[model samples]
Target: MEFDHVLSVRCSVRRYTEEPVSEEDIQKIVKAGEEVPVGHFDFKNYAIAAITDKKVLRLLAEENQALSGRGDPIYGAPLLLLIMNTPEAREDSIKLNAGIMAENMHLKAVDLGLGSICIYSFIRTLNREEGYGKYFQALHLPEGLKPAMAVAVGHTPMVQRERRFVARIPTFRIDGKE
Candidate 1:
């Protein structure tokens, strides 16, 4: 699919069908994320955990509800691509890299006719809640690495919403005059 088309159709999908994403599509999505732009310093301090296990998904969804006080934080998507960063990495770099990777994955999912949503609250819940160390360990994250965000992906029947243009665009003027 064309890049513009993918961007246009991409939306935050809160519900998904039971159809599992194909392995080939999963590979392509992961490759897109890995190809995102990292800083020139090449600080290889990030990792992605691609999870498709139903039990773990249920556990995380429950934890999210308890910690965030929101129902179905993952939105029932089948796959959870967790973006992790090492503790030693700078916070700014982590945010920048994670954002780039997440966007790439989201667009890739759309291009492949899958649905995706970037979720950071799940990571916050994981960090804030108790007894999650085992879950983190199960992911086998690199030493000191912790989840920064996630991308929930799956097959969905929901249609993408129309992109409405903003009525007024913000502008900057050198002399404080428009």
Candidate 2:
């Protein structure tokens, strides 16, 4: 798909079908994450995990619901591409890198004709919970890496439509000339 088309159709998909995302597409999405720019050229400080286990997904939804009172925080997506960062990284850098990685993966999903939504509440709740260590162990992340963000991915019944251009955010341009 063309980059403009992908950008036009990209959106947060809250509903997903039961069909699982193929491994090839999953790898492609992860590669997108891996290829993103990072702070201080410190790519080694970040990692990506592609999670598809049903049991683990259920546990994450349950835990998120318990913590935030939101039902199905993952929106029933069949896969989650989790972005993790080392604790030693600066807090601002961690967030910046994770956002970049998530956006890259999300756009890749759109390009692949899959639905995706960037998630944060689940990770926030887990980070606040006292038993969050178990989740890290369950995910088997490399030592020192912690979940920073995630992009839930799956097939969706909804069709993507080209969105009309709009200035949704306030902007001011200084054209390099007084």
Candidate 3:
């Protein structure tokens, strides 16, 4: 399919079927993420935590709810791709790099006839939430790495709402007149 068509086909799928995502597809998703552009310098700093355990998902949901006051429902997807930003890079670079990786994963999932949704609403509260940060620490993941973003991925279980399009207008005024 054309890239434009693929872009249109992709959407944030909030409802996932019970069908377990295949390991092959999972590998593709992860490889796609790894393929996206990280900055030219110090690009080897990003990592991920791919999770499918329902119990841990439940725990994460509760923590997210407690921190943000609204449950960040994962929609029971079989995988959660957690982007980690290692401290080796500058802070801004880390976020931008992670975003590139995420877009790659999203588009790759779309290309593979899969679905995904990015969750970014509760990060400010997450760092200070009781036991949340500690959980990461206890995991003995590399030091100086932090969770930047997460995406849930799975098969579509139902049809979503009608497609909505919003056109983009140039923000700058031409010669400060137009």
Best by lDDT: 2
lDDT for each residue of candidate 1 in 1-178, tens digit (9 for 90 to 100): 8776676678899999878888888889888889988875544788888888888788777766766788887788888888888776677688788888998999999988889999887677678654343466566555677888789999998876556645487786588665
Query: What TM-scores do the predictions have?
Result: 0.86, 0.95, 0.82
Residue 104 Cα positional deviation in candidate 3, in Å, after optimal superposition: 0.8
In candidate 3, position 24 carries an lDDT of 92
Model 3's alpha-carbon lDDT is 0.74
Q: How accurate is candidate 1 locally (lDDT)?
A: 0.79
The TM-score of predicted model 3 comes to 0.82
Using TM-score as the measure, the top candidate is 2
Model 1: per-residue Cα lDDT at residue 136: 65
Runs off by more than 4 Å, candidate 3: 130-140, 160-166, 171-178
Deviation of model 1 at 123, angstroms: 1.2
RMSD of 1: 2.8
143: Cα error in model 1, Å: 3.0
lDDT of each residue in 1-178, candidate 3, tens digit only: 5677677777888888878789998898899888876786656677877777676666767776776677655777878888887667777687688777788888877777877987655444576765345435444676676787777888896543335567687575468654
